[model samples]
Target: MTSNSPDRPATAHPGTPVRGRAHPPRHRQGPSPEEGELLRPLTRRQIADRMGELGELYTRTTPSGRRKPPSGRPFSSDPSALLAPSPQARSAAFLRRLAEHMRRPGFELLVAEATRPSGATVLTACAYGFPVLGDDTWWQELDGHLPANLPDLAAPGGLFVIGDILVERRVRTQDQSRDWNLARRLQKRLLSDHTAAVGVTLVDRGDTDTVAALLSWGWRCLPSADRRLLVLR
Candidate 1:
């Protein structure tokens, strides 16, 4: 049931050719309100097979903000911080990270697609992450210490890490009315499976816009050791 999308930039990962972006449905005209999106969980094999599509999506959503860590810091201790790869390398780096993340037990991915009046489908957004192990081994990657309660929260295995959330650029443009808040919706749906778990996601210490967006969406900032990373829950 793989589908392809049109209208995205033609960049692709080195060895993996970009075989058309996955549209999920085509953009239609008229004042008709946008339809609700379908959200579904993806198995590891399904996600691996769609690397080409996901890679393109990642490249399209790659943040264009500053890649450097705060002054005097060497990019938070998080291995996920790789100075925001150049446009040419974003696809490859993203795929590599996705591959690594898939190896973790309980890792999961969810994708969102919308149906147009013509009945075409368009891939609108996606989010993925896994439960934080009770051992707290994941904490070692942070550049700073966590709040006192964070460990206690994770101790019970009631913590989940949302690694990434991405929405198509056009979706945002078309959603200027704020009616959908698709990104927020994607996150909420993704976290629903964890039921009451304190969800956390890391943002590059320099990505102020994303941090602010998270805040607007009701996420709280958890203090860390330094300015290299901001943990939002």
Candidate 2:
């Protein structure tokens, strides 16, 4: 999955986080009272309700002048399910099903929410992660060849691949400060609460903003021509 730039990294290094093994699965328990008000976890239904916004968010990320995948979206199975459409119906549906098992190790999905002064609920952030072998890359085991020698996957962390942080287009321009603040809050809670050892992302050459953001969160980049793997403790 070639990552979208930061304007850019409102997501990753939530690396698509995991609740500490010390804590029970979130499905069985809730965050303690002290976690923070801004970082609240929502159920699958909660996220499904906002799938429309997610679809729009997918539209927003497309670089200007470039088409938004032939399906008018990315993440389409036609290309590859891992490269699924951003806000397509099927993508959201798949996400809904995945959300049920979100609290488990190996795979984790999160949809963080926050309320606005207007008493409206908003979808502030989302992230996805999964397990991978040492030689894994965005291309996976394509043709059974790695682009370069890569290190093993980190223990305790899932591969954070999708971190979507966006607000409504109408509010995005008028409330840039609020948007960033909310996104940052979501990212912080995600990183602090969960542990995604490494993030497997797809990107062109050079350490882009996505790489920098992961590094800031105690994640290191294992560079390869084939993909960008962000590792953590």
For this target, which candidate reaches the highest lDDT against the unseen true structure?
1
lDDT agreement with native, every candidate: 0.69, 0.44
C-alpha positional error of residue 174 in candidate 2 after TM-score superposition, expressed in Å: 14
In the range 12-56, model 2's lDDT, one tens digit per residue, is 365565333243323543333212335556555665576666555
The parts of candidate 2 lying over 4 Å away from their true place are: 1-37, 61-63, 67-106, 112-114, 131-185, 197-200, 204-221
TM-score for all models, in order of appearance: 0.70, 0.44
Write candidate 1's Cα lDDT for 94-149 as tens digits.
Answer: 78888988888778898887787798886667888888865756778774467777
> Candidate 1 deviates by what RMSD?
15.0
